[model samples]
Target: MFDMFKNNPISSIACVLPPALVNAFAKQNFYSPEQVRHVFTNELKTEHNIEYALAMFCSQLDFDALQLAVTYKELRANVAKECFGGWPRFNFDSLLDYSRQSAGAGGGFAGDGGCGDGACGGGGE
Candidate 1:
């Protein structure tokens, strides 16, 4: 989105994936356009402009909590190496907590750790 912090500041905020990147990313990852939209718009809810895509899907929307978290951790450690430089303390669990607290159970993720399988622990807890 930026080049050594010298690019257009406002435009740089946009996460624009080139056609080639979109095609390549699609081949490997499976997510809906809605999910991608939230990843970009989550800034209004959280201070950060962008979020761990998979984690946002899991924590802020209805998706597999455990599976998405595992994938987020892996991506945060592996594929998202560049992001680690700016984000020193990345924690999926904490992000989940924040998402839940901010949006309430209606936020949408499957549920927090307190809930049983297939149950939505959401804001009730």
Candidate 2:
């Protein structure tokens, strides 16, 4: 599955994402880079949607929300550079913000605790 993403625009982003998140996206019919980009850039149009999707992903994958949030933050620049040509023009921030809020409220992501794993590196705020 990882090998399949290597040939696309989201290669860098996909490489670092939790396998569950990648699989969740795949299950949602987001197989192509363009479709995935559309989800990041367009499909999630509101704070509610962002929060809902975050919660859904966490629930579905039993993944740590905080870890996912940290991963998202860590991959922001790569997503922008590799997929959007240095353009950070997307609603991904809303998703990040909502994820942070959800994590804070729930005390953590579903499975793990937080971003201390070091899997997430500095990318953007």
Per-model TM against the reference: 0.24, 0.27
Root-mean-square deviation of Cα positions for candidate 1 versus the true structure, in angstroms: 15.1
lDDT of each: 0.32, 0.34
Best by TM-score: 2
Candidate 2 per-residue lDDT over residues 13-59, each given as its tens digit: 32233233443464432133333334533422322223223332233
User: How many clashes show up per model?
Assistant: 3, 1
lDDT of 1: 0.32
Candidate 2: residue pairs that collide: 65-109
Q: Which ten residues in a row have the lowest lDDT in candidate 1?
A: 9-18
Instruction: List candidate 2 stretches off by more than 4 Å.
Output: 1-4, 9-64, 68-70, 92-125
